[model samples]
Target: MTHRQVMEALSGLLLGLFVAVLSSTVVSNALPHILTDLHGGQSAYTWVITATLLTLTASTPIWGKLSDLASKKLLLQIALAIYIASSALAGLSQNTGELIACRALQGIGAGGVTALAQICLAAMVPPRERGRYSGYFGAVFALATIGGPLIGGVIVDTSWLGWRWCFYVGIPFALAAILVVQRTLKLPVVRRTVRIDYLGALAITGAVSLLMIWITLAGKNYAWLSWQTAAMVGGGLLLGALAVVIERRAAEPIIPPDLFRYRTVALAALASVLVGVGMYGATTFLSQYFQLARAKSPTMAGLMTLPMILGLALASTVAGRLITRYGKWKAYLVCGTLLLAIGFGLLGTARADTDYGLLSVYMAITGIGLGLTMQNLVLAVQNTVPRNELGAASSVVTFFRTMGGAMGVSALGALMTNKVGHYLAENLAAAHIPAGRAVAGGGIPDLHKLPAQVVPLVTDAFGHGVGMVFLCAAPFALLAFVTVLFIRETALKTDQQG
Candidate 1:
């Protein structure tokens, strides 16, 4: 395919990518409103996000494997159809439980879309030229990141539109992407004997679900060292071990055990996990911080995050061109991870009183780091693997990244819950306010409804608790830096099967 033909096919793929990314980012600012409207607590809030990530993580490898055996274009369309239907259903959800279930369904589709997008892209472009195209991915991500919050905020804040519109808003874009893909995407279908490892998939899902439940519920519902913890943790480990065993013996494993033998693949997968942990875990709570602690409107909260998005857009585009021009990637990866750690560290010091200028600077540093790191990790793995293994190898990295994200959100959310509760209690006592007089439930409190004297305490608790969340995330980013440092760079193959 010529560059023009590649871009033409990519136009639809990028749109699909935009819809997938938009689904997640658009909900960030609206989540506070969504929870408040549903009368949900912190646990429910975490579950809302976790449900999607959990399913997306588990299903990604399945989709990737299927891509190897089927028509990529057809799979992409099916995924988009699933997304459109589930999203519409989600808009009709009357409660958090219903919403979470719908979101889980959405994840199945998102998993396919995410994995297939990269698979299709790799099929079209060789690794040497892929960098320049990957930059477009970063641009699409930036647009979605920049737009989702603002769009969601507006929809939620509008008296008539409501938070449900956030779910419905992406349907038109998704529909258009499907049409464009049908018209422009032309790829030769590769036929292979299809043998999905259902048992391996089930075991992986069960193990991840058990661990996620344990992470979310450990300190809140039971002591971390209690019998319940022991049972869940032990059970999760057993399931995980079972998954590994099943994968090793299966005719076609969802995640190929042999892929890990390659040092680049292994290190890249590990680094992706750490990056996901730090990035998803810490950034997930920023909307709450801006709204609950800083007392900003959802619209303003969206605007406040622009610096980060812009930084990401700029870094990804420039880095991609440079990598293609010079064929060196490790230096950018190393610098990007270093910047990630520094960004998280700086954000750790944030409180309700932190200046916007300073916060923007921190966010920009983080965004630039992400742009340089995320897609490049997959590019590194792709460059090393054979053409036939592209789908599996690429999805493996994404699978780990998303698995890390799910765990990060659950664990960090639990930590934030505990810290916030403690601070709220302490602040109430310090203010001579009775505990009973404070917000009575774990449901997110509306500052407008609180007594004037109590608002500052709630804000302070959230500010301090959220800061601690970012502080905890910094170590993970630092670890990612250390992990990627050992990845030996190889020149990208100019040929499809070099």
Candidate 2:
């Protein structure tokens, strides 16, 4: 394909990617309102996020495996359709339970978009040229990341539109993506006898579900060291082991285990996990911090996040072009990971009264680090793996990162909830107010509904909880840096190989 043709095809793919990413983030600012409207608590707020991440993590490999055997273009179209439909359905959800179900369905589509977009890019662009194009992907991601919250905030604050538009807003973009791909994107649809490892897929899904259940519910519903915890944890591990055994024996595994044999792939996978845990885990609650602790309007909360988005966009665009020119990437990876640790460390100190200027600097640092690390990790692995394994390799890294995100969000969310509740109880007790009454009647921590005297305590509880969440995530970011240090540098390939 000519350069023009590749760019043309990428238009649809990038739009699809933007839509997928947009869905993931658009709910962040509006979440406070959504949960309030639905009469949900902290646990419900976490579940709303977990449901989507869990499905996205579990279904990613299936989409990647299917990409290798089926028509990439058809799969992309199907995925977009799924997203469009699910988004519309999500907007119509009457309660938190319905919304969570729709979000999980939406994630199945997102998994496809995430896996297939990279696979198509790998098919069209060789490693040497991919960095430049990967920059565009990064740009779309940053754009979506920035725009999602802002748009959702606007919709939520608007009387006529409300938060439902956060879900509905992505439909048009998804449809446009489908039409563009149908018209422009083309790839060889290799026909072969296909064998899907359904059993392995089931085991993997069950294992992930079990683990997330444990992570989200351990301290709340059951003791951390009790029989329930042991049962769930033990069951998840057993199923995961069974998945490995099944994958080894299957004719076509969802995740090809041998991909990990390459040192670069192994290191990249580890880095992806660490990056995901720190990045996704800590960032998920930023809006909550702003809304609950700082008492910012959703729109203001969205705007406050702009520094980080700007940093991400700038770093991704500049780093991509530089990597293309220099054929060197490890320095950026190392620098990015180090900065990520530092950023989290700084953000961990934030409290209800944190200066916006200082917080912006910390957020920008984390964003730059993410821009530098996220795509390049995949590039490093892609450079080492053969073209036939591109889909699987790309999906593997994405799968782990998402799985890490799922785990991080679940675990950290639980911690945040407990901390907030603890602080609230203590403060309420000191004030001679019944903590249970305040908590039981309160839904989703709206400061406006609380007595003026109690507002300060609630905000402090949230602020401290948010800070602790980031503090917990900082070590993971540091570990990512450590993992990247051990990765052996592999020169970028100049020639296309298939």
Candidate 3:
């Protein structure tokens, strides 16, 4: 590819990747309002997110395979179209179920965008110069992540727009992304009637979905140790084992068994899993903490979160550059992991009484550590793998990280609800409200309309529950630190030849 060709194609890829990241995150601050206004409950909230993450995880590897077989540009446009259409449907939905279903469809599109963008970039850029460009992609990732909440906040707080606009707002961007890729993106054409590993894909999806469903439902529908957990988790594990058996024997596995043979891939995957655990679990809940516990409006909550985005932006760029310059990555990975653990542990202490400045400091530290660690982990894995396996390697690391986040969000969310529910029940009983009414079917209260006396109690209860989540999360961060320590330092490759 010529300079102009590569640059234009990469620009489109970055834009697509940026918008995909934006879709998942921008909805964070707006979710409580959006669901409540639709008369939905906590279950709706979980499904809305779970559906998207499920589809994203299941379809990502398939997209990577498709990009390897066909024209990347054509595949991207198709993905963008899917995202735009589903996003519009999601915005127009009248009920939680419809919104959840539509969001799943949107996630399928997003899965394609993420996988294809990275693979296409690898196809064009050599490994040596890839680090410099990787920094730019990292910046794009961080920027969208930061921008999503701020934009969501403004839209939700706008009287004329409200929460629906969160979905609608992306439609124009999706359209523009599609058009840009169509016009500027180019790739080598490959013609092949390659059959996908349909059975392997189905097995992996079924296994993952079953387990995630079980996790999402447990504690609420049944106890954590109930028969349902045993059945689903156990069955899920069995299916996963079968998937491994099949993939090892198949001609082409959706996730090849041999990729894990390299120790670096294993460690990077573990580190990614850790970052996902802390980043997704803690950052998402922070919005709830601020808006609900601190009595901040959605707009103000998003604004307050500016520190995290700022930190992410700074670290992603600077870390990428530093890696490019020094040719050493292990120290940064180790340091970033340690910092992430510290940040999350500190954030565990935040409560209603915590000052905004202190809160910002904790979140900034978390964001900085995450920004330094996440993308570089992928780079480390990519460097270790051969060019032919680039798509699979990248998607494998990305898939595992997202899987970690999915599980963390589900597990931690249940923990939060249970803890908060317990607190509210005790305090409400002390305040003479019936325990039954306090724990209502949903453990949700209409804050705007509640009796003045009950609001503080409820808010404090939520804060109490959330503060405990980070404490639970701290050990996982340490596990990640340990994993990163085992990754031996490797020189950064500056050339593009895979």
Clashes of each: 0, 0, 6
Instruction: Tell me the whole-model lDDT of each prediction, alpha carbons only.
Output: 0.91, 0.90, 0.80
Mind giving the per-residue lDDT tens digits that candidate 3 earns over 1-498?
Answer: 776788887888888998888888788888878877887776676677778878888888777766666787888889989999999999998988899999999999998898888887777776555666677887888788778888888898889988888998888888888888888877667756766787888888889888888888898898889889999999899889988888888777888789999999988887777777777786678878887788877778878887777787788788777777777777777877887888888888987778888988988987788777877787888888887778788888777777777777777887888888888877888899865544356734567766777788788887888888887888888899899889877776656555
What CA RMSD would candidate 2 show? 1.2
Error of 3 at 40 (Å): 2.0
lDDT score, candidate 3, position 409: 79
Query: Lowest-lDDT window of 10 residues in candidate 3?
Result: 436-445
Candidate 1, poorest ten consecutive residues by summed lDDT? 435-444
Question: In model 2, which runs have C-alpha deviations exceeding 4 angstroms?
Answer: none
What digit string (tens of lDDT, one per residue) describes model 2 on residues 115-139?
8999899888888888999999999
Candidate number with greatest lDDT: 1
Q: Which stretches of candidate 3 lie over 4 Å from their true place?
A: 1-6, 435-439
